[model samples]
Target chain A: MVDQLKPGKSIKDTYVFDLKMSERGMRINRLAEWLNGAENREAFKSDMDAVMDRFELTGEEKKLILDNDWLNLVKAGGNIYNVVRIAAIFDVGLYPLGAQQLGMSYEEFLETRNEKGAT
Target chain B: MAMIVAGIGTSHVPSIGAVVDSGRQNTPEWKPLFDAYEPVRTWLSDERKVDAVIVIYNDHACDFSFSKYPTFAVGAASEYAIADEGFGVRPLPPVKGDLDLSAHICRHLVYEEEFDITICKEMAVEHGLLVPMDLCFPQQGEWPVKVIPVQVNVLQHPIPTALRCFKLGAALRRAVESYDRDVNVAVMGTGGMSHQLHGERFGHLNSDFDNWFLDKIESDPQAICGMTHFDLMEQAGAEAVELIMWLTMRGAMTPDAQRIHRNYYAPMTTGMGLITMQDAA
Candidate 1:
């Protein structure tokens, strides 16, 4: 979970308009470059489908998707940084949560990993 | 004559410059974060008037691997290149290494101090060394001083204890002081304030622990001198507690010294902190 340093309600309670553009901001640019590629675009299309299926998208997010308006996602408070990073990582066949998400035993994952490598 | 100038402790986070390039530093949210380091960069380059720097940092699964990792590795090469780090080379000048001075220090540590450290004749200095150099010695086309990089094995399991690192720094001071050449040496210990970059706890940031760490490093390093790996990992983030490297810098300085520059910022899951102390003598 993202460690929220404060208590009480969320954004509406502590909304600050201070936008932070990171020097490492190129991560998004690079991700966009890949997302434009045929292979990455294909992968992201499926991942987007999975995200839509798994999580409830905000009304604005759904409209951005329906209209194919990429910038609208940012306006929805869904920072492109998160979307591009998660998508890129998924495209690389690497899951951020992995089996750990299910709370599965690491030993079982190790065995499966070894079996996959042997194959 | 031997003259130990000052001690510096700073974070060598891989993403600092990348964060800046991403335009984070320009925003009001992160401008104060970047502004603090401006003085640190100035002090290391302009005021120190340093001829040589002794850098202490650990490699992150680069250079040496888990197969057979040495606790302490000292470079004896005339010149070192920036490490690849599997991603790509960073934009920076080739790091200049002082071969003669490194050799003398190695010999002194081995023979006089009876300390056994792995001698590295051909080793590429990683971003750990490069980041600090970039921040401290910017503006100049190249660094004005030569470098001596001391690689530590803190990534892998069963790494050296905090006390061992402290003693190694003390040994390093003797090695520098014994050098026949008349050169002023500055020691830099690079690592963490409080951050965990890998695994599920990846974005962990502990500013309170980072500030407490900065205070302890200056006033009573002994508080953290002999901490166990488990203890460091417990209080400090797993990836963070590596601040044990600071003990080495503290060990290099005299018992009493005035802390000149100190700053802390937790812009992005990593507590970017820096402290500079003038030698008491």
Candidate 2:
């Protein structure tokens, strides 16, 4: 069924946040979803380890969040949007996270776009 | 009876909202994009007199977490709170929902159309719905029109297919037209043109594909409906598959709607595009 949906060509370095990925990233995502509240955000920010422990995030998952590895987080089944929430707790915004995911320096990433520093 | 006046398709990039909120819309880099929407705001308020908007957008792990995300959800609440979205709650007013119209549509979709949408009472809208609202209606204090948010799960896999999205739009038309109300409603589809924000392919933008999509959505929606999720992701980037939401707006319109205004801008990673159409009279 899945193969029927695929085209002849495929995209590299692109991860589709599909059902398999969603199931894989459930724990990390649950922890990230809690950030929607101010109190939860503060709790995560104040003591990252405690919050991670409470969420029961695996060691690899904890490492991904700690390393600020946005790409790896996605690889570990973390949806990009939820990963964005996790990144925010560490004061990392989407653009910088995207830069890290692409293995580009922030300056280099900005240079690739039509409107640089517009946001 | 309620009437469908216009259909709108726009990118709901989060950065666009940040630009508007920060009052930097007139800056050289952002002016072209912001200026494009000025006429849309005027058209909705002055020309269309749109009393309500059915905003078709995706919730990005804000209101519906991945734990139990629904494939399709409809907001039946009287008011929707603005979500924090991790950074902080945006300094925006709560969105007003037309409960009577929403509940009617929800019932119609489930019983008559067999869409089986999850009905939401207390959905906190994030940038997906709000950014498009900001684009089409730059409000001062209160929004000019009430909104009925139709949330789709575009982030997760096993999302409704392009054809399914288009069919939902068609069903929406029936629901809107059947409502015995003296109101003009606009259907707004918010999401991508083309851009990827994940993996090594981050910052992907395909202007050619985006432009093609804009044209096809207006003239030949069936072509778009024929595309699989993989086809869209392969050609337009993984995240660009969100464009399927636009079909919901297009499907609600007449087969030969008149395209009034169209604009496309690839400023950052996303190919920000806007197209407005009115059903043929």
* Residue range B27-73, candidate 1, lDDT tens digits: 66556556777887677667877888899998754565433557788
Residue B210 in model 1: shift from native, Å? 1.2
* Interface RMSD after interface superposition, each candidate: 20.2, 1.4
Best by DockQ: 2
Give each candidate's fraction of reference contacts reproduced: 0.00, 0.87
Off by over 4 Å in 1: A1-119, B19-30
> After TM-score superposition, what is the CA distance of residue B177 in candidate 2 from its true location, in Å?
0.6
| lDDT of model number 2 | 0.90
DockQ for all candidate structures vs. native: 0.03, 0.78
Scored against the native two-chain complex, candidate 1 gets a DockQ of 0.03
Candidate 2, residues A1-119, lDDT tens digits: the string is: 65524645556887677677877888998999988899998888889999999989999999989998888999999888888888988888888999998778999989988878675
Best by TM-score: 2
Q: Name model 2 segments beyond 4 Å from true.
A: A1-10
Q: Candidate 2 iRMS, in Å?
A: 1.4
